[model samples]
Target: MAKFYELQRAMRAMRQSALQRGALAILDLGSTKISCLILRFDGLDPSLASDQVGSLAGQSSFRVVGSAITQSRGIEFGEISSMQEAERAIRTVLQSAQKMANLRVDHLIACFSGGGPRSYGLNGNVKIENQIVQDEDIARVLSSCDCPDIGDGREILHAQPVNFALDHRSGLVDPRGQIGNKLDVDLHMLTVRAKTIRDLAHCVKRCDLELAGVASAAYVSGRSTLVEDEQELGAVCIDFGGGSTSYSIFLKRHMIFAGSIMLGGNHVTRDISLGLRVPISVAEKIKTKNGGLIVTGLDDRDLIEVGGETGDWEHDRRTVTRSELIGIMRPRLEEILEDIRTQLEIAGFYELKSQKFVLTGGTCQTPGLDTLASRILGQQVRIGRPLRIHRLPQAYSGSTCSALVGLALFAADPQDEWWDFELPSAGYSSRTVRKAVRWLRENW
Candidate 1:
């Protein structure tokens, strides 16, 4: 809930500052790519402040002034490996983006994947004063929650209030300004190792930029890719990147569960390199150019030239059937999806009233991936692209850009949560919520 309040606050601040001449930036720190976007807000109307993200109307309010991508460094499996190296990389990428946009941005919001994070679902109830649930009342109720100590070496990444109820009614997006004596809030809090966050913050600071906010890669991916219907219904988003695959489950347009696997496209490349006895660079090029899991009779006859670095004409010239390549790739891909399936099960994903799956991120581009994933996940599956924006180049429109694009949309229309509300004594506890779930299972 605190994270939700912080995001809401940042959104309000961005809206107010949109009238300024310079651009506001969004930086996505992923395992595969570090993307930077510089946005120029043209209108004074705050409603036009954000890039439309979730609106199904396909509105055209904001335009992307400039965007750039660079190979990420000093990060492995979503965590920072070297702070100085990462900082240098951040400066280089942002400078390039600024140059392209012809604008210098003072503020930047960053997203990250690995933090050794943990999540908890918390719910609280409060009796309203004067039988009216105003914004302050909501804030008060959230404040009343005796938030747990998320451990010492960790920082709170996102404390989002996912759902709320007024009296006996549930699924209220906004309970503010409503007349009600009883108010309830369902919150999702994500906490990461403090060292991981500090490293990211230090890197951003070195780039001479203010860290407006930071978000979990999984949460941002969910925001960028999942459709409104998928969000309203229960669904999971699996973001497969270069070195890690992040997962988040959303219901009622709010995130409920989040996690990541320490495996990605890089692993696939490694597999190809080791199995085919080729260089990593060559393996990557081959994967990007001809990688696919589903084998066909046509593929058996087709041969791909395998380039060699030794430059010996006789030894360098080699060819392999497409089917042999798929043999090496399919096992790694299946392992990734299976790991995600394990996470979903642990998160009680099957308990959802609706079960749908959306796959995105760079690695999701492998041909026939959706078919392979659906067979394992056992749910309706589709590739997701970033939504709620206009003027995006068709070449940049794909599942891979969802995180970067969603970061932009999240910068626009942020939602308020329990942390923004006031806190009072004598509220419900997380244990109580868990107990209630257990009771429901026993009774229903």
Candidate 2:
């Protein structure tokens, strides 16, 4: 019951505030870039019913006012390393985005990537005194859940229920008003090191803006990347950012697992920079333009002219085979996928039996990534892009924009966050638990 009351309170507060207009910023604190987007929410337009903004599944109706990205200076592995440096980088991006949008944002929702994210699947049950589940009962059951003793210096990132069941019939999308004696819930909780969140909150607080919320990059990525069917049946979204790759699994339209690997596109570039003795800039260019896992018949003959700073002819004309370049890139890519595979396995991917997978983020755009990923993941893998939105900038409409677009969606209609809903008591659990579990086991 406590959880439900908190959820209700949050919803009430949000409804009262309405978050109608002006500017709101979403700061993506990444290892490679500190991106800030300044969005001006045009007041709801009834004439355009399609554009209404609220928490509705598969419904979006917001337009971007401005967006900007800058190189991150004080972040490593997606966590803030230096507050001062990160603050400066954030200011730069915010200033540029505000200038372009002609708006100043007082509210911000920040997304972060690191701090050793861990996922736990929790089940809570309550028996209803009566034959039906009530709001209070729902709240009581959630409160009954013995909140696990997360290690010291750790904080919960996401603790939302992924699936719910009532009585012996599972797959109950919504358990409210159901004629069931018991209630059962399958929840996915994600946690991160406490210091990571503290640093992020501290940095943003110093920026002179109110922190609306903090979200996992992987969770937001899945929001924009996974198609409706993929989300419904279950799918994993791998976000290959510059500094780290974040992963999230969704089943029954709710996020069930989330994690991140320090290895990312930056590691690949570094490997190329060192292996080929090329400048970092040139290595990045090569990775972006010619990097791939699959080497073919014509690759050996293709030669790349290395660019030089001092016009030094000695280092500028070193030609390397495409196969060699692929050789350098392939292993690192495989390692990332292998890490993801391990993460999925740990999170019970085999039990899900989901054959759909989606890859998104800036690094995922590398040539031949889809083919390579398909070979490694052994699933129907595809590169994913942000869902198309009206008035989104051309530059922010690609796979890399998944998190950004999803941030907007989250603001417009956030799912029942941790503090959103309540749980039922013993009465409800006794009536619903076994039946619901049995139903889910059979359906799944």
Candidate 3:
């Protein structure tokens, strides 16, 4: 724990320096592609972000000056499978984005969808010695929470103090400066496999970039797609990426549970390749140009040319109807949705007072997916796109770029400093931790 927090402490300083320079790059690494966005700050104060921006998921006081995306290589299920290839992809994407921005950025904040994320809800309470909730009380109560055994080789990616309570009153977002006997807090902790993070960090290092901060795709995607009202109430966001699908549950403007599955849109593409006896690339193109879950009579007549290789012209130039394509896609999509449903059930989704599900990410663009999700998941379903960012290009404003745009929001958000709620342990940097809490109190 001390080791990871120290890394975060360094990242906090790096982020501050980059923000002071008025430019920073945010990268979203996924199984399908890697996207980079360079945001130019408009002389905005971090301490006044939420108040000035009005809490829109992607509406922060930052303008995207440059953006580039490249096909991901050597990544599976959002995790780096080969260090050299992943590093090459990162460098290529960064160079392109930096070229467009005409400015060099040394620091980067990255988000990824792998790591097998798991969420834990923890609570702590402590008596206030000064009869008022202060930074020390916040730290002390946070330290009092019983840390769960998250297993060996797992790293805590996010430990956000979501809810605060004072004495008999509960559900306080901030309890500082309030007179109280006891301060209680509800914290949401997200953990992932340490190897995934370590591999990503190494790849960034090899690319000659500082990994200032990292976020799970599940959590950050929810941050950008769920509106303030949906977050205030209860909402679930399913980010359907290429190799993995992540789901996050937010209530009271904080994430309570998040999980990911290895299954995603890529599996459907594989099914198409096998079912149509075509190459993976051809299947991918077919899925993108013509893919959906619901089939109509018109689809039966909609013939799609599934091009291929090999000397057999008839087989190489084979064609299939849209309905046949949908047939191959729907079953796999249903399996993925069923997995999400099972995860939600395990996480007690039905217990949420108002469950709203928002399906986003690159894979969600398949036509009629929302309708199928509504049938399998629940009636309350909507296809969500990331919130509009300031000066984002039209090409990158689709459901596919939700995580990248959301990464921009995460870079602008003070909530990334959740590690500031550290335990009062030996060698604790009290001043630094207190500074993070102050920022959250003033801005978050």
Model 3: runs farther than 4 Å from truth? Answer: 1-11, 45-60, 416-444
lDDT of 1 at 3: 47
The total of clashing pairs for model 2 equals 35
Show model 2 residue runs off by greater than 4 Å. 1-22, 50-61, 309-313, 421-444
Over 1-444, each residue of candidate 1 has an lDDT whose tens digit, in order, gives: 444455555554554464253457888887777888887755433454354444433133346777788888888888789887788778878998899888878878788888866888888888888887786787766654557777888777776778789998898888887888899887887888889878887888888887777778888889889888888887999899888898899988888899988999999999999988899999999999989999999999889899796878865888889999999999999999999899899999978878888899999999999999999996599998888465565655778788887877766544432343433434667789899999999999
Please report, in order, the local distance difference test score of every candidate based on alpha carbons: 0.80, 0.78, 0.86
Q: Between candidates 1 and 3, which one is better according to TM-score?
A: 3
Against the hidden reference, what TM-scores do the models get?
0.86, 0.88, 0.90
Candidate 2, overall lDDT? 0.78
Better of 1 and 3 by lDDT: 3
Which predicted model would earn the best TM-score? 3
> 208-237 in candidate 3: lDDT tens per residue?
887787888988889889988999999999
Residue 363 miss distance in model 2 (angstroms): 1.4
Q: Rank by TM-score, descending?
A: 3, 2, 1
